[model samples]
Target: MPTITLSEATFAKVKACAEPLVDDADSVIARVFDYYAMHHAMYFNGRLGIAKPNPIRLPIGSRELTHTRLLTATIDGRELHRPDWNSLTREMHELARKRLGSFEAVRKVTSANLRQGRFEENGYRYLPEVDFSIQGCDANNSAESSLRLAKAMSISLHLTFEWRERDDASHPGQAGMMGWDPTSRDAGLMADGSSRSWHDATKQAIERIARDRPRREFTLAELEALELGRVVKETGSKGATPEATLRRVCQELRDEGYLDFLDNDGTYRLR
Candidate 1:
């Protein structure tokens, strides 16, 4: 079994936070692990698994302390294990950039890393994967003060996923266990059965206009008079005519059974 040790300062902060709720180092470690596991499970849809940890001693400054803990857990029978830390860190940085209104400023203060290990218990093996140690430093504070603050505020989230089953079975792992790519956006359909990316808020506006004036057979000129046409014109780049965009939208609506093409005079009625 491999022992994972935290720095002296980190251990002190963790002990202080856990001391109020539990007695002894082992209980404190278990409580912290449980808290993280519960929150992680809540954030992502997955089954919760059990974690067992054994406390060990390590030298911290002049004192011998139980700052190292050996953890073992099995995470089989779940569709997804846990979210990737790199993706979470990138999201945090992006959010910070938006909130702070400066990308360069926020980039200077955030960092994260992933840790992994394996263990065997009672003839069964398990792999332990902790998500990250995400740290945020205050750029305005003095170097020493900032370091202290960062150490106190640092968070290490833990999670586990099954790896032994694939090895034992001598087969490749299931693709579903890998989870969805964080950067990939799922394609969504609009009311007209067109790709949601085809237009901005104009799609919703078009639906609203059609629903409001169900009995009204709209010509190209009449449709262009509505808010949907104005939105398409405003959002479109130069040379992208509002009339052309509106015509395409109507055709899509007609194909999706939401609109009836009235003759060949570029007119449509809501179905």
Candidate 2:
């Protein structure tokens, strides 16, 4: 029922941060802040911008030519401000140095070497170049971890309704709120209106539906057939379409790993 607006620059930054993980808006905002912190730390600390005219000596190791080459390789020919360039190069150098001793040693380290060395290390090894995958039971365990995270956040349906006494001359419109938490099968109601009894009854009905019908799979048509569908329609919230709301909620659930799409179809299965 609420609308959010942002400036073009803010919207662009959010989108850029969300790339390859666009399903979660909260995650996108978090990542945008993280990116800003890493790239703009120096600027915030009184540097004019990301680039500086002078290059400072980095503790990358003994070989000067190899250190320069490594820094250049990490930058990959990007037109970064000098400070940003320096920071990125330093990070890469430290990462490499954790495993390799000197610049020359790090220069000899390649993706192939990383892949080969991954299994050789123990206790949370950091192999930057390795792409690791677990098959069979390990993947099932990973899925369970995702499920745990989703459950920790809990799942709920939030409904807000506005009410006014049509026959009472002195009454002002009041807002009411109701929410159903599927995890606990609990429904809560808060009202600031003369129609408190009606809102309370509505909340009870939502609780009954949530407790009794407990569904693992969801579809727009299925959701529209429920009591929630009627409630949303009766509320007359701006731009609140039953089908769109159902689709958006389903997408959010899927992104949080509480649900998974089945064969890229319109239906979703609880994860």
Candidate 3:
């Protein structure tokens, strides 16, 4: 079991915060990631064996570690390029744009290892397998905010960590972090004050996601591939000429209740 010890002052503050929420005294204040690791908050889709991967990157400085040591020290110790964190962050940013999308900035939220100015370095970044998805948890603070970001961003959001807000809610690992009761179901989406499938009213939302895509168009093959691949590609690139006939065709088919593979043909087509 992994445990973290905090300063007495921080502990006291977190304890005070947890009092109104639970029946027992909370010992560990966790982050979104921590709560997830401890199995406090859970997501349903993981049981289905669906996983998406994400990279964890943090910034560190030269003082904390020498450039030579970082560059050469493998988990076992070996020769490599610059060991400083700034270089690592730059590399990770490139990876994110290439794999996820161009707009998923890797700089602002990155971390660094600074050792009293011995060297100015940033954090390290690497890709890991992730299930579900990522979304920029925006203005709201409840668990509902997480789902909203997932839908609106049209991307998978790792619900492990989110921005902390005293006004709305605390960060996932805060002293009084909210947990999902076993009986709670995923909050259904709404529009016009009615519950609907995620596919409902997603055209505009999907379009917004496409705005961030680097490609100007997707081919017929690409469209089906994305769908089957559990990706969220859509047909709304800015000023796409002729609206890329293939994408339009796919959207039309999808909109008309045609989203299954034909048993006989082994291909997706209109119902």
Candidate 4:
């Protein structure tokens, strides 16, 4: 490995960016550069560092995500970390007890009726506040359960996962790429635009259109006419006229390299 020495001042700054026990030297450097590149509209070539690309922002209950190795969750602005899904479940219960008031209320929302199996088989974990099972689940089921529990308790949970897609098997040794999943459903929780944002809805609509439609290049008028219903269904807030909003989102997507605005005439070609 090549060695690059840092001065004492630089080393201290790097250490400050570290996530205590979770991040090592390589990851610390990778994170700093990734943040810089994202804001400056630059790209960081993979050969320069061990870190993989930065994580994407995903919606919770995304059916497509199978598993994640590490997760950071922000519950109503309070952040917490857990190593795995089971730990996340336990942490959610603890937070719900503190924030959701009565014990019965928590239990009513989280309990799985215990008639079918023994405690060990079910992987049941008992707390004074609630009793819930956390074992014998695949990643998809676990993620779904977490979403269900959060919604039932009216808890606003924003989750970020360090994970790699199945196709990334080509680079088996690479560190996990990150993705954020905001699962909060409460109307009051819409304050941060996580739950209700025109931009988020528009982004989702574009992705859906890209995946479902065969055509790569779409005129602005066609997209506005075709996807207005989808965007409206995804989010309740739409601030501007449909044409203006779609135009702004398409321009943003073009700037982000997901599409190209050819000839400046409002036709978008997927990139």
Best by TM-score: 4
lDDT of 1 by residue, 1-271 (tens): 3467889997886777542322456545655665586678756555443232332211001011112121221112222233332223333433444454553344344332112233232221221222222232211111212221222223212122221222332122211111111122111122343334332343455556566764756677766787656655654323557777667656645644666888777777766
lDDT (10s digit) by residue, model 3, range 92-143: 3333444444332322222221122122222212322221122211111223
**Candidate 3 colliding pairs, count:** 32
In model 3, what lDDT does residue 8 have? Answer: 88
Give per-residue CA lDDT, model 2, range 1-271, as digits (tens). 3467879998877766442311246545633443565577776883322233333221101011210111122122232233221233233334444444543444343211122233423212233443221111111122222222222334332322222223331112333333333444333221222232222333343344444445645555665676656754543223457565455545545554555777555665554
What total of clashing residue pairs does each candidate reach? 0, 3, 32, 1
Q: Which ten contiguous residues of candidate 4 have the minimum total lDDT?
A: 184-193
Write candidate 4's Cα lDDT for 58-145 as tens digits.
4333333443443455655677643354555667666665667755555555532222123443344455444433343434455545
Please give the CA lDDT of all the candidate structures.
Answer: 0.37, 0.36, 0.29, 0.51
Candidate 1 CA-lDDT value:
0.37
Give the range of the ten consecutive residues with the poorest summed lDDT in model 2. 58-67
Which stretches of model 2 miss by more than 4 angstroms? 1-216, 263-265
| lDDT, candidate 1, at 65 | 11
Tell me each candidate's TM-score: 0.25, 0.25, 0.19, 0.40
- Candidate 1 Cα deviation (angstroms), residue 56: 53
TM-score order, best first, reads 4, 1, 2, 3
- Please give the TM-score that candidate 2 achieves against the real structure: 0.25
True-structure lDDT of candidate 2: 0.36
Report the alpha-carbon TM-score of model 4 versus the true structure.
0.40
